[model samples]
Structure formats: C-alpha cells, structure tokens
Target: MTQDDMPRTVRTLLRELDRASLATILPAEPAGWPYASLVLVAVDHDLSPILLLSDMAEHTKAIKADGRVSLLFDGTGGLDQPLTGPRATVLGRAERIADDRLKARFLARHPDAALYAGFKDFAFYRLTVDRAHLVGGFGKIRWIEAAELVPPQAEGLAEAEAAIVEHMNADHADAIQLYATKLIGRAGDGWTMTGIDPEGIDLRRGGEVARLAFDEPLRAAGEARKALVALVGRARALP
Candidate 1:
C-alpha cells in the first residue's frame, strides 16, 4: 500500500509484526506434508527470518533439500470485528546459518530457547523473503516489500534508547506533565515518554499521545548520548 493510503494503526501494527517472532510451516516426517510444525522465527533488521531448529525436526531436513519455506504470524487486533483479525504470510528461500554472530542475535531475542540452543542436533537457518502479504483487517490488505517493512539501525542505539527510558521514567515525570497540559493542549493529569527510535520518541499523555522526531539524525555514540540528554532537558523545561 502507498504510504498515504495506509492507516497509521496499520503501519504501527506492521512494524510490531516485523519485530515479533514468526512461525514457519514445516513438513511432517514419514508422512504427507499435511502436518506442519510451528517453529519460532527471528527476523533480522532486514526482515529476513531466522530459524533455530533441531535435526530431529522433519521440517529442518525438508528445508535443507527444498530450501523453500512459508511463515505466518498474527497481525494487529480488530476494533469492530473480532473474527476479522489481522495476519501476515511471508514466502522466502531458506539457507542454513553457521555464522556465530547471527546466531547470537537470534538467541538474544529468544533467550528462553537456551534449553535447546546448544544441542549438537540443533541448527539455525535464515530465510530471504521473496514476498509478503499483510492483512490489516478483513478489507484492508496490502503487499509489502521486505526492505520497506524492515527496521533501521542507528549507532549506539541500544544505550541511547535505554537511557531515554530511564531519564523520562525517573526525573522528568512532570515534564510529561507539560506534554499533557500544554503541548497536547489538554489538562495535566498523566503523561510519559515510553520509547525512542531513530525517527523520534513516543509519548504517552493520560489517554492521549504524540510522536516527537528529531530534526537531524543522531549518528555516533557521542551524538546519540548528547541527543538523549537534550531530549530529557527539553522535556524537563516544559511548563
């Protein structure tokens, strides 16, 4: 869908789905491909799927031979209709992964899988997507490019992100107060900044909200640190 034609909630849901764990449909062993096992998948910053599997999984062996796969995941929830929930499906080519770095990222996001992470029988695979179908709702469907749906990487982003959350949740609890009272042009009751990204910071004010973006990119580690400090200061200075 064109950026203008896409709804804001739909866009947000797409991003969230990109970050969520995916389930790959693996063929069952010793039988018809009718049975599919659900496997947890990690998506790289580029929106490629990462799979950790056991040698015992019939699907893993099937992937080694065919190198083709499909993934499915739940999308955003519906407001008007319960049955019309959002969902997504991705078609891709799979490859076995032996890289330690990629494996680390996959494991980090799914630490709970450590129980089987180290078994010699387990392996990791990466999926290069060919196309994706995103269903925002019953009538809202769109095709998405893997690149357009991927997340961005900013240097020192993790540290900057954590610091922003800490400062906002700690010192400037009242500046959030001003966001609710003045910037939003509403009464002061409850407000806070919950998350930050390369684009901007997400603010929660009472039941209302806003997204504040930076005029320029925060490139280096030093720059990100300075930008976050300035952001906290700006919030604190608000009336």
Candidate 2:
C-alpha cells in the first residue's frame, strides 16, 4: 500500500499511543551509529510527539548534540512476533519546549512521571515531525507527510485543553462511558478522558488507551463540544 491507500485509522493509532522507541544519533566515539531506546511520549495540540528527558540520560545528551531522531511505535502485544502487527516510525527533530500546559498534558497521561518531572536535571522536548512511515501489516506500508497527520493551529485548543477536559469528564461522564464501551469497545468504569485534540479524544481506563475519533477534525472548543454531543447521540442509538 502507498500513502494514498493509508487509512485514517492509522493516524488514529498514532494519536492513541503514548510510548515509542526513539532512535537518535549517538554523538560520541560510536558517532556514526544509531542508538535506540524506549521513551514515554505524549502529543501536543498539533499532534507532535512530546518527550520528557533528563540531562543525564544518554539519549538526552545525544539529542542535545543532534536533534534529528526517529521514534518507532509498535503494536504486536510484546515483541514475540514483531513483524505481524502495525508499527510506525516518526522522523523529526526533537527540540526543547518550555510550555507548562504540554508538560501537564504529559503528566496527566503518565502520573508516575510527576516524581521526576520537577527534577533539576529533567526537561521536556517536543518533536517537530518531518515525516512518518507506517507498516500496518504485511504488505501494508506507506509514508505520510507531517502535514497530513497534524492539525493546523487552534488557539482555543492550545490554551484551554485542561478546562475542556475537566468539563467533559465532569459533565459528560455518561457520554464518556458510552464512548468507551459502545463505540470504541473497551470495558471498565475506569474510562477517563486523558486528552483531546482536533482529531480525537483519548480514553484511558486503568492506563489502557482507546481513542474515539471525531467524524471530522475540530478547531474550536465549541466545535468539539458539538461533536461530543453528536457522537453520544449515535452511541445511544447503537443497538
């Protein structure tokens, strides 16, 4: 398959995941070689990857020297049959971001990170994605340009995500439940709306994630609220 044949669901998967295998340039004597490591990740309002790094970590040291990197997200359960499931590689440059909201967004997804989030040696970095390669399965592969996957600037979303999420989780608890069980097919009362972007809402229950995508991308909080109402309408109608 080619980029033209790529499904929107694939992009949905990218937004749903919070961890990735980051490959960065090794800066020392192993100069020309690549180094890969697991990283906990989050997505910014524009869908770019956010990373929390420590100044003392090897990868962070390398990133400071050469920002260019790639993050691979795999979906085969474990790595037993790594070739059988869908995976994606994001190619980009990882630069430091000082946004407090993005940091909060990340902490919401990985609360344990809060322990070290304030460490003097730790900081946040956001990847400025250039392109992505996705392998959905055998013979199902494509290269996607960054623009096709990220949303354009939405001022309201960037500035008010915390309040928007609070409103949804507080007032629309039932709708959130409907989305988790009926629409996206997940179980448990632990369903919590972890994050929402122009493309979709991220649902987490006991730390397991499932994304509920909007029929179309949204740019404003009002638009997102309307989409939630419509989606709940459809979810209620489900037999």
Candidate 3:
C-alpha cells in the first residue's frame, strides 16, 4: 500500500484487533521511566482507542499521574518475520471518560470484561490521539496525523449505532451470517454483529472476529438500512 493509504490501514488495525500493548510513563522518583503492559482495547466512533483500566493497576495509576501514553497494535502474528508485517504505534494522552455508548462498544468486543466492568475501581478511558506511526512491512511506513487517522464525525450514525447493532443481531441474523461467510470469506457458524460504525461492521462467533467494510461510508442513520440491504444482495449474488 502507498503512504496515502496508510490511514485506512491503521483504522482497520485498530478496529479489528482486540488487544494492544499499552505504554505509560512511570510516576515515581525517576519519573521518565517507561512501562508497558498488555491491554484489551476497543475504538469509539471516531476511531479513538478506548481502554477499561483499574485504578489498582500500575498502568492505570501511572495514567492518573501522567496521562501521556502510547499503544502498540501488532498485526504480525503468525508471520515468519514479525517486522515484515503491519503494526502501528498510537501516541496520545488518555483521560477517563464516562460515556455509556462507548463503554457498550468496548464490552461488545470483549464480553468477558463485562464480568468486572462494573467494579468500582474499573473505569473507561479514551486516548486523545495526537498522531500514529504505521509500519506496513519493508519500505511502507508513514506518519498519520489524528485527522487522517479518524474519519469525519458521524453524529447521526453514532447515536443510532447501538440500535442498529441490536436490530441486525435480533432481526437479521441470517443476513449477518451471510455477511461473514460470503462477503468476508470467513466460514463460521453462529456469527453475530458486535458493533457497527460508518466504515464497517464488526462480527464475532466464539473467539474469532472479522470486519466487513462498506463500499462507501454511511453518513447518517437512515443510510444504514439501504447500505446493509445492498450488502445482502451482493453477498447473495456471490458464487
């Protein structure tokens, strides 16, 4: 892919991957030290990374003290040479937020977190992204500004996202399954819609997940039905 296409690639990596390595500055006597840990992650409507952290965790405590952080999303799994695969480093400041829709989005991607999500010490935080660095194999690297990394604001669709996800999983299970098996070429049973955004739909069945991107983004809630129906037609027509 060219440098111009790196932004979309970064967004895909952020959306499809469920976990990342979170790096935070240590808040101690020698304050400039760096700490890294594994973290489960999800993205908000505008592609900002969302994290659920506990006040007791070292990273969380560090974030409270100094919100500046970096998250590494590695897409090099199973590759013979890891450096020859796609990966991204997102640099930003993480601040705790209290938004139900975003929390639900995170939970939908990570159902197991629902168990401890309500604990008093656990809270949600979003990365206020400054920029990202993408490494797409050899000779394919680029720096993506926050504006290019995230799509334009889609307030109408954001407000309607939960309802859309519920409606698809509730009333259109067959269509959703087709989307996974036919459109995305992933053959799996019990596939269901986990989240929907302007760019694509996130699907999961058991431990596996997949993303099916729209040909064109839906700018409003009213556009979703028509776009989804068109996808159904396209999936059905595939031989």
Clashing pairs in 3: none
Clash totals, every prediction: 0, 0, 0
Taking all chains together, the TM-score of candidate 2 against the true structure is 0.89
TM-score of each: 0.58, 0.89, 0.95
On residues 6-78, what C-alpha lDDT tens digit does candidate 1 reach at each position? 4333334433432333334445444335335677655453456678888877777777667777676665444
**How high is the lDDT of residue 177 in model 3?**
93
Off by over 4 Å in 2: 5-10, 78-84, 152-155
**Local distance difference test scores for all models:** 0.60, 0.83, 0.91
Model 3 misplaced regions, further than 4 Å = 29-31
RMSD of each: 7.2, 2.4, 1.4
Candidate topping TM-score = 3
lDDT of 3 by residue, 1-239 (tens): 98778999999999888899999988985677999999999988888899999999999989999999999999998899998999999999999999998899999988889999999999999999999999999999888899888775555987888888899999999999999999989986899888888898899888888899999887777888998999999999999
Q: Which pairs in model 2 have colliding backbones?
A: none
